[model samples]
Target: MNSSWFRKLLLSYLPVFFVVVTILFFVFFQSLNEQNRKEAIKANEFLTQQIVLFTDNSLKTLNYQVLRDTLTADELRFFFGSDNDDVYRNIQATELMDDWKMNNPIIDSVYIIRLKDNFVLGDGSGQAADFVDQPFIQTYINQKVTAGKWTGKRSFRPYAVEKPTDVITLVQGFPHFSTDKSGYIVVNVSLSKLKKSISPMYNPKLTYVRVTDEQGATLMSDSGADGENSVLSHYISPYTGWAVDSGPTGWGLAHVALHFYNIWVIIALVAVLLGVFWVVHVTRRNYKPISQLVSLIRTSALINPYKGQSGNNEFGFIQGALEQLLEETSKSMQQNQEAIILRKKHRFQEAVEGIVSIRESEWMADLLALQVNPVGAHAFVLAIEIDRYHQFIETYHRQDQSILKFVVSSVTGEMSGLRDATTWAEWITDRRLSAIIWVPDDADGEVLSGQIGEQIVQWVQSNLSFTVTIGVHGIASNLEEIRRSHEIAGNLLQYKAVLGTGRLLRPAQLEGSEQRVHDYFGTIHGLSQSIRIADGAWQKHIEDLFSQMQDSISSRKEIESFLQFLHQQLNRVFLELSKDYRSVWKDSGAELLELGRSWETLDELKQGCLRVFEEMASKLQALKDSQRTRAVISDIRTFIEENYHNPELSLDYLSDQFMIHAKNISKLFKEAYGYNFVDFLIGLRMDKAKQQLLTTERSLQEISTEVGYFNYNSFNRAFKNVAGVSPSDYRKQQTS
Candidate 1:
């Protein structure tokens, strides 16, 4: 009777137990699936943000360059300067626009609107009137003119086209020349080309990405279906008011469903088998030893034991054990997941620092498990540094900087994933980030790496309100060489101080392909001559010297040496000058030396040097002016003594011959000799006339002619006025 009752109880409760366990398993699986979906959605959002940032940055750069080039173009300037009907000048302007359109692949059309003449020229085949008549373009022109500012990206219909399509354009007004009227340059960037540049930012298999303007009109999108049960993520661009949306592809939900189905089947099978075992054990309770053995077998599989007499039945034991087993498994899985993530981070850090001490085989295995394929790959290191790091720090708080750094790393990682390149990025320093990238062996590693580096730089600049400089090291064939590549990359970053920031530096660039040794000694000699004599062209020479230094000097050490040489030469000249001059030179020289140490680039250094030279040249010019005044007065007196007999020799003649103002000549003559220029000339003529009258048997007319007087009475009267006697009496007095 006891055995039958126990079997009935087991049959009734076993199904309930199985059903409860199945329900618990389904709930757990659903929760896990939801968590995974959230993570995927977050990743999609990050990638979309990166794509928006990259596209906006590329468009801004192209637009700015195109506008600047067109507005400042020499051909345009010449065209504006020419007569309205000048066909040759018009042709040149057309050719210039054609060349711009051809050279820049992103530029679909180029045009100019002359505000003065209302003349329009475009690269399109139709007449200029057709382009100028477009209402959208007219609005752009009016808006730009009214605002008196350059227009940002604006959507408009292309002019002079049979079928008009929406085109993104940037418009800027040309500063009116003194001779020509104002005009506007219109640059149309190919929206299709802009879309193509950023197309690689999305992976079609993983996500469907689309770019839309503020009005929700689609600008660009990948070819993919929008699947059900997918999460949507959006990134809004601050530059263009555009939004980039991304969602999982068609297979994403199906793959998730398949994964959950497998887990559910395994749980269901385990529950049924346990129910069957419990029923058999209860029916055979007469065999106490067998029951004990079965209990032991079940206990070994379970994580907890049942306690007390009432709870010591087979059903109670199974329930307790299964609950405890699942709880313990959940804890173990959570810990293992955390541990795996921690280990991967630690390994990556070690690898980036080139301090991994494990065996090569073990290291490679870890890398593969982490999805960093090092085998049959070309590897390189990219070092990224924030431009104007000091300014960046000053602008943001510490917390904000940390957040920005994380954003940059996330963008870099997502971009690398999209490119199918195995890359790991980390902040190696406060203001610098480093990435180790591996590409397939058959791929063009250099080209691919350059593209990746450019995208990262552009994206960060657009989103972060700052810029970055990237340095790429030589590609390596094996993992062992990555450390060397990293070191080289770090070394390459030092050149940013000389080459200027916000650029990419490669190993080949460091080899000085475009740089040459400048003529430092020649510059030093020219500056010396200029300072000594106060040459008027000294400023121009200084400008040219610095320009050469910027373009030709590659090595920092060499630059420093050149600067030191300049300081030394300047000091030598300073020592030879007077105290006042030395003081001025000393101050300027000190400034130049200080700038040499702190200037961020050679261009900055050159500008500082030019300023110092300008100061010194100004002081030198003052000194030269003082000496020149005295010399001018002395030369005028000498000329009077030599030409006193000439009738036309006068102050006006002297002023015209010497290019000196008559007023200035008179003032200087009085200051130097205590006599005015006219009085000095009269005194010289009278003295010469007295000598000629006394020493020669000459007539008054001849004497007057010899003394620069046109008539005898004027000479006699001038002599009497100067000497208080006639010319004859003056001669007699001199003779006595």
Candidate 2:
């Protein structure tokens, strides 16, 4: 009866125990899964940002290359210039483009359009007009673009292939990479090759990355896990305006991490089940016999017979449970301790972002628990960023990048630690890190100067391949001001474009900059008038524009705004001009305007702008010269036509008749009609000779006399030179 009752009780509770254990495991696994998913999303966001950075760097490199070749490559000079009729040069130029495309797989094709003739050239020969992306090229040709920014993805069919290819194109105009009517160099980047170039940054098996274009269309996506779940993170790039969607193509550590949690829960459940079975066995043994009861009680945690207490078994049970609890607690604490640094970083990041309200004491207590809070002090934030981040990224591998970031955080923390303050630093971004220092309110002014930031920069420059720039805000007197301090520090980093990178920037440097006023309208008007007349002062106007920016602008946006204003003024000046002059700016002046778009400093801007402005002035001068010579050449042509029968008629005769120099007439004549005085006169005589030869049945001598050549032999020679036959034979062929 007792055995049957014991079995009944065990069976009744076993189902409930299993149900409860299963529910607990399910909840634990669900939480683990959610955390893993969130981590995957964050990882994917980072991957997308890296892709944008890489692509932008590559584009800048290509732009510089195109500019260099167009200006300095001797092989392409004839092809892009007026000597394009040289078929060998056409071949050489085409070969050079082929080399560019071959050297970089990212460039699927390189095409050039001579704006003068609408003549196009690309790889392997065929410039397919109907279906080869000529419509897009035609659109840009019709509309004058001030500068070339990277275009979004489009179907670029370089040849008349059966299928169209997806490409992101870079349109750089020749004469200057930015503007002008010379020609355009359009580079089509293959999405597949772009992915291949970027593939080195990640493990393909673990995750997949998709890069979109400016239009939010997918340009290329690496082959990753083929499912929606494979894409765990999606973000739009601020720089390129492209979207990057990333997901686990297969189970990565983050994706399979929940399974580990599930396994742990299962192990724990198994232990609990073993404990239940041991208890059942102990009870079953106790029922074996009264003789075996004491031995069973001694071996089990059921009772302590030596104590002889009624509740001894309860004490033993509590002792055994406590022992198990202490062991598990020790393991749990180890796990928690491993996460301390992560939690500290998380807490600090939250405070800096204002994601958590810090006016309350709760934040302070949390910081204290994390062991990062100062007892009594004011605080400020320092923003340190890698200078020339594009170069930095290109120079280092993924692991080296992490190591450099660690070095940054460590040096920042250690440097600030030497002072009378508590400091903590963490990577706030891939290329930037932040440090928060709690110092005494009476801290010296050096807090903003030759102290921590200077030392950090010196060390990084000395030891690392790259240098860093640092920016700081005023000390935060209150808890709520910490986020503002951080934000101000971040803003100060922008001055690297002005003040130069690799230095410590303070709030004092920004003082009085915002209050300065600029008068651009007066100078802009002068520049326009000067450019219109091919005056040298237009070059000086460019300098003045840059000087205005340097003097009045303190921020990047302000500089860009001033440049945009200057561009509009120039545009307005030229738009009002005639088409002949308008073409000068539309074809060539835009390139000069483009010079200002990507400069790092006012000096760079001044030099590039000056260079292009000088070119624009030169072009305007040449155009004015052409206009002056046009009327003289016109009169010269009329006199030649009227005096063709005068055998002594020559360049000197025409120069005397038109009152221009003989050499000038020859030069202007060739410039206008692509023939010199002698050849042109010979052509007019030859036409009259051919008409008379075929219709009038005139003798060769009389025909030669009637033409400019008084000598019959000279007339026959000139006639043959022009008509490829003797005058008598040419006449007979037509007469027959």
Candidate 3:
């Protein structure tokens, strides 16, 4: 009967005891349910995985076997493409199909349809019109193209009396992978036998399993107790594109737990009620000390930013600060998400750029995660560049620029998707977006890419203020091919200098000129020769060089490279000129060299370089004609007079010795001394021979040999022709 406050508080512990006991019971049941579910999932997934792997292995083996025979086997190839059907070869082909059936139980029938004359060949059925699968064969023959891979499940009846058996077919074009409609080779795989190989016997009461195609349509469904309502796990068959779903019977662990433990539900409700009362008792006792501290903090001005926030009595300032922190945290999280997206784009860029290499499986996973299509049998890469990029920059702010680029890529993606082509696109620069597109092997990926390019150009022109140029690379078949595609497509944008903008540019349009590779060394040599002599042909050579550049459709960078090379060579030629003859070229050439790099097109480059060349040629010719000529000719005359005694001394020898051209020396000789190279050499040699005859008494051969003639007869004729007398006769008269 003692009424103490401690006794009342001790009595409140009774409900807390029951609450703790009930929680333990609930946790035990929850753990058991979770454990059972995990076990079921693991077991089912394992079995489903076995089905997928086995099916893939078997089908892949058969596919490769037939593909190999089609490509390598003579009998099979002859049966498909041979105009004259040899009976022995037909039997050999039948034997091959029979071997396929004996080794693999999955092969139901194998046949060849020669599209040329509606002829069919199969097991025991020669090239006859009475073939049972004529209608089926004609369908593929009429389509004129066959799939290289196995097709989805379809019903096939080999004989008239038999019901349709579900089969997956493999249809290959004649010559294995070619696109010719000349013939087709079809292999029918029995779905029943394939499933039998995966699992000979599967129970229906305990679980449900279904295999579905890419369209989510059911291709094969097991006799299951629960149907699809209790699907626990799903696996995709990489070979057949069918989904493998497995699950237990209805209600699984839940039904058992619910029915057997109905009493626990009532007990749990009672425990919750007890928990509520216990919390109330504990909170009242705990609130007195904590509330006093909160009251003191509430009076502070930390949360007084707004009336609504500051009005709360206890813990209001703390809640306001927490609210602001949470808001900031959310904003930071959004930034982090954006960073994640940017990282994904960066990774893609690296892959296409071949900066970072990844395995095929990992790259495929990344593409799937990005919602980008995986590589297909036929793929293409496209580069879309904004027209007049400088104008584009001035027309929009940075944010607007990003938005416009995003629209470009997004529109391309949508257009390609509508065409049933798989596409991935991203902006790789401020004004350029790149995309990789893939279509079914049977579809025309190059044509699709062209159509998509045209649509993008038209759409942008209609909706936006700017248009774009699209450069499409040729077809690609694999990941490595895609990297190559990226390089070509990205490089194609430089062709815009010649192809122009606001249109679709295809490989066909640009491929012809890309092969028109012209070597510039020859033109460079000719230009150098003309400049050395300062001939009028310098302008003609310049025109020829630029015309080749135009015909080749060289890019702006290529043109710049050529011009820079031209400048370097011409500058070397200019430095050799006399100072008084061409002092202004040293300064004017620098200004012209700078101007050379600013050309936007071949025509501009051609015209600009032509003007520079005209000035240069004029100055060079003037310099060559003035004091420079006098100085060079004087040196030439002195060298010939001293070297006339040497047998090899002549115009070519003097030209090499002086580092000048023979033709230039000949022209200068006639200009300076009023005689040709041969005439001057003869007159000098005849004078020396007469002096030798008068003083040394040398023979005619010795005198001719001493005067730069390897052949004596040539020197005798020249001496006689130049001095109007034979060298011997002239020497005798001068001596007497």
Candidate 4:
């Protein structure tokens, strides 16, 4: 009864266990099949590699033949003399050997190895006769007679075949041009060297590689097998009628299976169990720190004043502490913000009192007390108000407010150099900035003001396409009365006068001499000035005024003040000129006056003055004759030669240096030099080229570059034009 019951239980479990075991067996068998197929491909790949190796050897011999033929036909015939000429042969070989090695370093020796003549010339081991009748040498000679070319691989007859042995010889035949091709110019290469050259063809990592000759003899094997039916026996060399075969051996497959089967099965089973345990453990523990950190971060994210302090445990103790610290920090920050607001308000009041409070600056009072409080010294104030800051904010979005503030702060830092002398700047209001710069007591405040204005204009124009106006006040000795100066500057900036729009202006330039003003003012003053003026007298007067202003201004404030003064005076003059000759200054006249009224305050008025000067300069440019323009062009050409090393110096810079229009200079240069300005520059550069070629032994390429021609072809063409010869020809003539 017991035996029957046991058999029944076994029968019941047999189907389920058999099904599972069968599935496992099928998977295992599939893996083995794939592995076997991969091994077969690896073997085929090895055979292909051996074929490639033989092909490379063959190709090398062919190349040798071609190179020998070229040398015999070209160098040996024309420049190297007859084959019998030893001196010529030695010199030729010395010159050409290095070049030959560059292409095929496996070529053991290159020489004229003769058969009937029995003469050899090169650095090789044996006599010429020893190799004269060798199979490869003879075959190449025979083939050359009919096929016009010969090359192959053959073993040296007497050489031994052993480990680390010289295996084969590569020979090629070349005919001497001196005779009717009696003998050969030969190249002999060692097969051992050739083997090394193509060793990469047989990879030991993926497959075994073997080489076999036509006679079914195994010639070589990466496995170093010497037995019958070795790896080489199955290989077929693709070149030279040889065979190669490669594949995983039975022993290797067995080893791989045994090695991997034991290792991977254990590792996989263990890894699955460990991974499941680790996941469970980690999932349970991961939330504690995260929960604690979340609470801490939430505390800091908002303004929380009573967050708890952290504990000493590792689970986010510091995070809790940080939350508590953040709460305290928020309270402190609120107090500081309120304090800062009060301080700024107080500073604003002081600034209004002419104490020149520099906003966001803790050190302004110290700088001003030290630099501006000296008796008899002058202080110039300039207000820089950005136009359409709100528009910028709206266009860029509120996120850009911090960025703009950073930009303003950076600009303020750059301008802080003036603060070395007790000059300081402050942000008075949003988008509005002010600067108070002290000048020497005896200095002309207008000059300083103009400088400040010009610098502001240049900074705005050059760094960003923004507009700002600077207003300057008259010099003030008494610090107590500086408020009047500040007010005067502010009032001048407010004036809607014809002055530079983004510039500096002073009180003196705003008022000016009444008599000289009327010269541009009254109708009679225009008449007297028009026809009676000397050739450049009026221009000189204007230039002199600017030059004097440039000389006197030492601070940005003074420059703005100076610019303001010049603007107002020039505006009055321009208004008078417009009234006198309404026909001459039509739109330009009205444009100047309109530009003047756009000034927001006395600061903007200074900017308007510079605008008037620029416009007037443009108008006077129309009066310049072509001859005078040509002279100016000549002056510029001289400047280029003197400043060639200055990389920043360019045609544009030249125009700026002369304060003339670049286009005008270009036109005048074309008229005077009979070529485009750039072309003339090329001519000048050509002269430099000729000098470099004749005076120094620099390479033609270097000479070409030194004179600024990036390419040799263009330099050659230009050099021929200017020097009447090519660079090489010029160099030869100079040497002679």
Candidate 5:
């Protein structure tokens, strides 16, 4: 009877025990799975940010080059001043575009259209010619000129030789200086190339990422997707009118709750099984304790084991009380577990909102020396990137790579050493570390930078055996300026000098600083030279010079005083040199005049000064160069543009007209503009062709002869090479 009861009891408890353990296991694993899901979502969000970053970077690059090309073309003296046939001017424009294309391979072609007439001028390689009458062209021109911002992804003629290629053209209208003609600058970038450029930066596992305009038309997308499946339309990017999507359904809330259903199913099964078992166990367990207390009291009353007072003995009373308390405590614990779960929900909500903050005063305890008291403090940042880290991962076993990284991390920590008041170190990122120090407020920046360098050198030598290049930035007043200083230092790092693998740099010490100083000092020299010898005004003039140099160096208008000084100095030097040799003065004067025309930048002015000084010294060294040659070359260049359309125009003709050798003329022409005479003429003719093709109803034969081409065959070949189109095909695809 005892054995049977024991077996029954064991069997009864076994189900309860198993059910309780299974419920706990389900809860634990479910919590873990939820954590994993949250991590996955966070990772997805990070990837989305990366996508935005990459797209913005690509646009910045495109905008910079596009602006440079547009401004350069707009400012060209010949591009604005030409009075030749419209066809020749158009052709010249196309040739200019080819040069831009050669420099920026990503840009397919660049063109211009007069918004008033829909006059199109471009360099494209296919039969897709510029159309002045197309609705899309008219819309693009009107919208861009009015908005004054680039209009994205408008249809355009491809080229004169090939099929029309889909392209994204940036259009903006720039008015002509003289005439009422309002022209638009159009930069056509092949959609295929844009897609190609952006696609490779994305992960292949991604469904598809795209950049679309405000109209929701796809501007660029990765391979293997139609418009509906594109990642761009899924997530909204408030910063740039772009959408970034990754993982799951490529939408917002669906991605967040994708795995919730499976989790709910498991939770339901665990809850139901545990509910039944818990009810049975509580009933049985509660009765046993009560029954034990009753039996103990009854036995004490009947048996008299404690003698005459056994019924009310301390032991009997205590036994009954302990049994009752044990049963109540277990019940209370069960209730409390449910209550604790409710409290946890509130705490979890707070964690999700991510609003934790500590008072500013409390932050000092955790702040690094580099971060604290940064006002009037010199700080620098270093960005260390591992070359082809992804490629390296593919070659090594996963376990081995992990081990290597562990070793590297361990060494980095060991070498960083202890932080102190004067110096501090931080592991800024996984691949990079930074060390910052406090120097005296007026300390020599170079010396302080050198001390930091020595510390890094010693630490690296004693720890890792691998080679590393260190990029050091000069000191700045605060941590915020550290970023820009670091950029300057990084650029210097890229330049090869005697810098060793363990090199150090203070940007203040680079040739970049020297250039800035020269600008400052040049202003002073120019100011002194501009005015006649006014007595005792040198100090006042120096102060004024410093004040003016503080303005932007690039603005040519603000630097008029500096230019005037340069002109006066050139005249004075020429006069002084004329006493020794009259021919020398004339040569110097001609070189200075030519240089003045090219001095659009301070760097250009510097180059001009250096050249003049070197030439004058050559005479002191008893070397004979040319006085008349410079003047002749400049005159010949001016003549070519004014008369390029003459069928009799030739290098030999120009050389004979100017009484100079043809070879010498060719050499001078190449030196001045970096293109051969024939090529230059072809370019001039092509620019004219583009204008006429877009502006006039002239036949191809008439346009060809008007641009100085005698034979149709020669014009066709030259036009194709320079404009990437034939004359008639270029004219047919008009878009006004």
Candidate 6:
């Protein structure tokens, strides 16, 4: 009877329990899947906004600053100011523009539109009429000068018979001469090139990002076909009036749904099987307990044993236990998924920050588990920094900045993988991203790493409209040295202060191989001596010092130390000079200090230092020139008196002795003594001859020799010329 009861109970409740559990499982899983989808969509939207912001800022910089600088450059100005018929100038202009275009790959063709001549000079082959006659070109000329305007994508031929090519141009105008009305500068950026700038924003697996003009014509898109039924987000750039649209693939949600469906099937099977087992055990166990109670009532005449009996209590316990188990299992699954995501993120952060310091064995094991095995791989670290980072932060909202960083990190990671390197990247700061790369051991690691770094820079510049500078550390032999490599890369990043932005820096560049440490103390000592003597050579000394600093000092701190030492020595010398000199020195020093702020390279700093010294030298020379002329002449007379016995004592000799020009010495002597240099020297010699004859009674020949005369006859003649008497007569008169 009990066995029959158990079978009936199992049959009644099992189907209902299975249905309830299955419904709950599907509901919970569907809710979680929807949440994940929404989160992913939000992330996509954020990334799209960042793409738009980057594109807008990049365009503005190119138009207002880069193009302006190019147009204003001396090379372009030479072409702009010259007549079109001037062949030499035209050639120079063409070459200059071509070179500019080459350096700036984003520029398709650059044109200098002369309004007065109605001519257009460009990097391409063609006459002015070929480009100047285009309808869009004329329209661009008609517009008033404002910020640069885009010409929209259009086809044009540079030569009459040449095939037309499509380009989008940025047109800007400035007066060729202040009064000239007709000159304009037109810079054409190819639509393809402009599209290329934002190409990094597109990832087929993540989001579809594209830029479009006001007319809804696509300027650039990763794929031509928009996904069907995809969720689209749009960001309109305020600077360019262009729309950036991004969306996930239409199949993304469906794929997620399919994934969840498979998971649900497994979950439902497990839940159903466990529910069946619980039902069977409860039914079988309850039969024995219930039968014992019924037998007791029948045999012992227990009056109320069955009077207040309720339905089997085990069913309620089984249902409650099943619910508890299902709840705990669902919680465990969610926790596991979250833990997995957290672990991956943590590992990536640790790797990029170079904090993963573990034993070789454990490190390899962790890397394998994390799917980033560094064993048998060549390792390198690349430190990437955004150019104009402060401006980037100021231009975007806080959230947008975060999105930009995330997008950059993602792109770097993707590019590294494409290059067959295992890459881990993270944001080390607001404007810097650091990546650790591991490639096959036998691969050309340096070249491959450099290529990857350059691609990252180009991709970011082209697609996101922002520039990044990458510093590549040297290749490491193994993962153990990766942190040290990372340190070297970080140090190399400081060279951006010297190398500027939008470049790839190599470890070899900063290793000072091309630099030679010159004699710093020797140069400084020379400079000090020159300053003290007020010699013009101080300028040269200063120049040499700065040159040595540039070549020898790779560290900013070392450079600063050298500069400080130079400044202190200068200050000491200036303090010893006159007030006017001190004031001039102070002003020059201040100017040099101001110029140092803008120095982008060691060479620039060197030039600035030279300029300061040159200015000081000029001022000192002027001060020396302003001193009393009479005092110089007086000193000359004293020098002549002491050296009267020397035959070579003439204006030339005096000039050399006093460090004064020969002509100046002669003219000053004539003015001060009322006689020429020759007459003055003769008078001094005659007077000295008379004194020698009167005092010593020496022969006339001896007296002549003593008075700087080569012969007695010349001595007598000199005496006559000065005193109107022979040397003997002068001597006799002196005796009387």
In terms of lDDT, which candidate is strongest? 3
- For residues 175-220, what per-residue lDDT tens digits would candidate 4 score against the true structure? 4333344445555556567656656654565445555667766555
Ranking by TM-score: 2, 3, 1, 6, 5, 4
Lowest lDDT 10-residue stretch of candidate 2: 303-312
TM-score of each prediction = 0.38, 0.48, 0.39, 0.29, 0.34, 0.34
Global lDDT of each model? 0.73, 0.74, 0.75, 0.55, 0.55, 0.71
What candidate 5 gets wrong by more than 4 Å, as runs, is 1-7, 24-28, 74-77, 80-91, 103-109, 115-118, 123-133, 140-148, 152-167, 175-181, 210-212, 215-240, 249-265, 268-736
Clashes of each: 0, 9, 0, 59, 42, 6
lDDT of 6 by residue, 637-719 (tens): 98888999998998889888999999988887777778888877887888887778778968999888888987888888777
- Model 2 Cα displacement at 172 (Å)? 78
Worst 10 residues of 3 by lDDT: 301-310
Best by TM-score: 2
What stretches of model 6 exceed 4 Å from their correct place? 1-357, 361-376, 386-408, 429-432, 440-443, 460-467, 494-501, 509-518, 528-539, 549-553, 578-580, 587-598, 610-736
Mind sharing the TM-score for model 3?
Answer: 0.39
lDDT, residue 667, model 4: 81
Write model 5 residue lDDT over 518-633, tens digit each, in one string.
66556556443432232334345444453444333223343444555655654664455435454654676578667755453344455565566456545633422344566677
Question: RMSD per prediction, one decimal?
Answer: 34.1, 33.0, 36.2, 22.2, 34.5, 35.3
Clashes of 3: 0
> Which regions of candidate 4 are displaced past 4 Å?
1-207, 210-248, 251-314, 317-322, 325-332, 335-426, 429-486, 489-515, 518-736
- Candidate 2 Cα errors over 4 Å, as ranges: 1-346, 440-450, 512-518, 528-534, 572-598, 615-635, 652-676, 690-706, 716-736
Candidates ranked, most accurate by lDDT first: 3, 2, 1, 6, 5, 4
State the lDDT of candidate 3 residue by residue for 1-736, as single tens digits: 2567557656766678778887788767866766776787788898789878888898888888877887888877766656545677667777888877887788888877766666666732545476666766666666743477777778876555677888888887776556565677789988887776666544556666688888877766766535544677889987678889987656645435424444555667778887988779786885676688876765874644234543654545576667767877898999989987898789879878888788778877887877676445678888899877776878899899888888888899888888888887778877778888888777887677888889989999999999898888868876788899888877777767666668877656665674243467678778877876877887788877877776777776777777777777767876776675346566557766767645444565567777776786776667656777889889988888888878777778888888989998899889888989877877888888767767886788887788777788988888777778887788767867
